[model samples]
Target: MGREFIDLFDKWATSYDAAVTGHDPQYRDVFENYDTILSEVVSNSEGNVLEFGVGTGNLSKKLLDADHHVIGIEPSKAMREAASAKYPDLTVLDGDFLSFPKLDIPIFTIVSTYAFHHLTDDEKGKAIKAFNEILPVNGKVVFADTVFESEETKQEIIDQAKDNGYNDLVYDLTTEYYPMKNTLQSLFKQNGFYVTFKQMNKFAWLIVAEKQ
Candidate 1:
């Protein structure tokens, strides 16, 4: 089901930005504060960064501007094409987050924005484990995604979605997949990373984890 969503995104890649602009303001914050979030985890001299789901080169441009050498892994061919066209020098690969080809180079930081939620529970665990295996000691993993505070809030989000004509957005079995603070911290800890989370809004969280 999630793979189908990825395929849809691939097809929508050409007009992805335009289709999303103003239609979903929640995602806009993720793009807007991307630089600030990256700066929090990466030092000026941080080298060899990897970005998952580098859709349309939105966050890739910011990482490149920060002087970090970036390699982006994206599953969608259309999205990757858009990114390649926009940033011709970028190293963008068409791959899934769970099975992205590992680079032999030592990684300093790994960043993913709005991409984690697309993973299933098992996939999330595998992805985090893979991240831990690839990242060097003290390397960082920063992820930002939508999170629900409580069951009520989660229901509210679903209700809002239905109201907004997104009744077909029920791919996940439970909305609880969007982890709360404690759940996210525990997941990171279980994956051998020390975690810190900042509430970006009522429905969004920015989490930074350092390899242990």
Candidate 2:
């Protein structure tokens, strides 16, 4: 992400939590499903966690409440500050996933929710390799994001939106880029992780990759 992007998020930091979760049923479902997946993963692991794009500490708060130590890496200063204020005890860092300094500590699990789609395909590949370097052999990377499975699916969604009379649906979808699930799974496997994907809904996906 660039400085301009960070600035945009900084401006939205305060309202992000409610803006994302309050109005849309799909957005709320993303949160609910992510909570369940994150909880299940944390419950099965004993090691520390590093959460990328830990916006407003929504998921981090849940991990902390479960007694899991989490280090949150966020690029936007305002977002980081907001997360820090919400969970004073949690460690929140200011950096993007691709450029963040590698940590010295062992990461049992690295997770991102509703965040990874901000990256382009090449950037996502670099992120996968970076995570591979920092994690143990058995460590896992859990990613949950809004995505389309293929071009056909994306087009179907576009058609549905138009038929349903959503004026801005096509414009909105065209502006933001989301990785195809198969592309991400291929990236994970190529980087030496065993990957499993779960479709949370028509446009949401959760991928759990364990180092092989």
Candidate 3:
């Protein structure tokens, strides 16, 4: 799954919150309206929630605060520990998008933020298919992450990041699993979902894919 990025996430555990809070200029735009975005994800989700990539549990806290029964799955041990430290009661499992402990309870909604890009397009398709199997009819997948309009537009953003000397950001854009709008639309539909996209920032889009 996304374990290939675990070392980076382990190293980033202490700084991840700061980075998302705009302390890192390289990622400022990517994390624009960070608080509002989390709130939007929380608002869009309902019932028992399974949150993949619960890095530092920021979004999990929001879900819990909203009185939702939430279960989080994270691959990085360090990230999982950090999230546990932040919220002792929350249960964050060791897993990724494609592989995780099977949940027994009925899950009505799945929510993730800024983390799904760890999986490639093929992996993403598999994840969506798995969601179809796990969720009830009309169940939703609410994710807010970086996505591009097209390959050309993605290249433009990467070029800008390079010009600004944000080499890490460039590397992330080039290496991570950020997908195009059409690609995601097709993935959701092929797996029996009705999807919608709302641009949340220059780099991020809110994707709501409901199981059909």
Candidate 4:
């Protein structure tokens, strides 16, 4: 479903690693504490993770390092190739959140980072519903992404980016489907999850949604 952005991701595959490592000044805040954020996601994750939008497999690498079995789904071929090159044994497949290869095994947790913003709120709801269908009770969804406190906060951040002359960041903030915290809480509750958010950095929040 997020395949529309594949070309951008394919183009970003080579440089994405550098950007996340704080080499790109414009996105520094967006990816603030990159390694720590990935580590937090890995720590919060449970057994058998289904990671959507596994760009470059940063989180996947950490999960494997922690000895967690991970299945990664990504929409970009170049990104898949990049991760595969990094971890030749990791199973990264071509897919998106809403429609990935069906898993034969049960998933204890779903983990993703910086990628869920690609989905609109409605699409996110549908994806969560799909996740609910697969996961047993008490299973969790641990995601670390750019989640704002409110619409005002979102707009203020965008305006600040504009004042900094970060036109590219502004464009990304405007184009992507990032959601507010309260809205996500309500959405998760409606779909039978008790979700909590922990601020990881200026932009990203670590969300743990336990299926109830």
Candidate 5:
């Protein structure tokens, strides 16, 4: 959670989009669910949104296409540049989720995908609390990422990923601090968020947490 993290993304930014979107057919379902949930939330929400780990801005592009006001925060300069080039109208800042500067806006929704996993469990709770403080009543956090039922389930996913020719993804998953779905729900609820969850597939899920 330092320069190493930023450096990794900077190095991969050029190929990150294809590496993710074209990883495998199974990953297609992940993006579909992310877009579906994001579209549903954006359509229902009342104010603007702040997206963390905007990466190449695929999700923000969709949000912009739908006419939702969005500001993106990305720690990687290369990724931010790519996103900026793709959407010159977009506002992309340089910062990570745990360390982003506060924005002055009526943010009704916060969205992130596969980015929060960089934080440890305690940090995840802190991140959620920060979201609560920033959002007013009824604000929502739409989080979509890799989740598991248990350690065994996580290991199973790793095995399957390696078998499916996504060895790099498997390695990252194994090394990263991916949280269990139930644990994540508890963290959300503990931080004054009423939560709803939808499992997109075995390895991915979406959490919609409304501020109380």
Candidate 6:
């Protein structure tokens, strides 16, 4: 399922930036909030940062502006192409998060947004383990994604979408990808990271984990 989704996204890459940029303002706000979260975690001396899913370079551009040396790994070829075109200087690699190329240099911080929830539970575990293996003892990982809200809230959101004329388009497309917050946190905890920061909002949660 994950591989199939990746392939589909690769096909959608050509229009992804336009599609997402025009998406509901809430979606864009998620990424903006991520930048705020990162500001709290990244220090002046923090070295190389790895972004697991550098989709279209939206987040990458912000990180680059922060003066961090950013390396991005993106699985979709089309997405990588889009990112390369936008930020030619970014080190974007075509690879899956589970099998990302191991860098000889130690990582300072690992970050991903929206993309991590696409992984199945087992894959999420493997991803956490991989991050642990690559990060130094005190390194941090910050991630955020849409999470499953209560049935009432979820239905309300769906109903709102229907009223907004997005029912047939966006709602159905995103329903399948919603994840549960506890489930994601457990995966990280099982892999030896401590969840230090967690903020749950309407339909998403942001988490910051530090290596113990």
Q: Against the unseen true structure, what C-alpha lDDT does each candidate score?
A: 0.71, 0.76, 0.92, 0.90, 0.78, 0.69
Give the per-residue lDDT of model 5 (tens digit) for 31-131: 54555655554554456988998888887888888788898999988989999998899999888777887787778889887788878888899889899
Clash number for each model: 0, 0, 0, 0, 0, 0
Q: Write the per-residue lDDT of candidate 4 for residues 1-212, one digit (tens) a residue.
A: 46677887898899999999889888999899889989988888888888998889888999999999988999999999999999998999889988888897779999998888888999999988988988899999999899999899999999999999999899889998899898788889989999999998889999999999
Write candidate 3's Cα lDDT for 86-154 as tens digits: 999999999998999988789999989988888889999999999999999999999999999999999
TM-score of 3: 0.98
For residues 83-112, write the lDDT of model 2, one tens digit per residue: 889889988887887877668677888888
RMSD of each: 3.3, 2.6, 0.8, 0.9, 2.4, 3.4
**What clash pairs does model 3 have?**
none
Backbone clashes, candidate 2: 0
Q: State how far residue 166 of model 3 sits from its true place (Å).
A: 0.5
Local error of candidate 4 at 129, Å?
0.4
Indicate which candidate wins on TM-score.
3
**Model 1: per-residue Cα lDDT over 1-212, one tens digit each:** 14546766676587657633534443343345444654554442257888888888867887888788898998888888899999998999877777777686788888876667777666777888888988888888887777666667777767665666554344331442565566667778999999877776555577788999
Residue 58 of model 1, lDDT score:
69
Best-first order by lDDT: 3, 4, 5, 2, 1, 6
CA lDDT for candidate 6 = 0.69
Rank candidates by TM-score, best first: 3, 4, 5, 2, 1, 6
Lowest summed-lDDT stretch of 10 residues in model 6?
36-45
| Residue-by-residue lDDT tens digits, candidate 6, 2-100 | 554676668667765655554655344333454454454443225678888888887778778778888888888888888899889999987777877
Error of 6 at 180 (Å): 1.2
Which prediction has more favorable lDDT, 2 or 5?
5
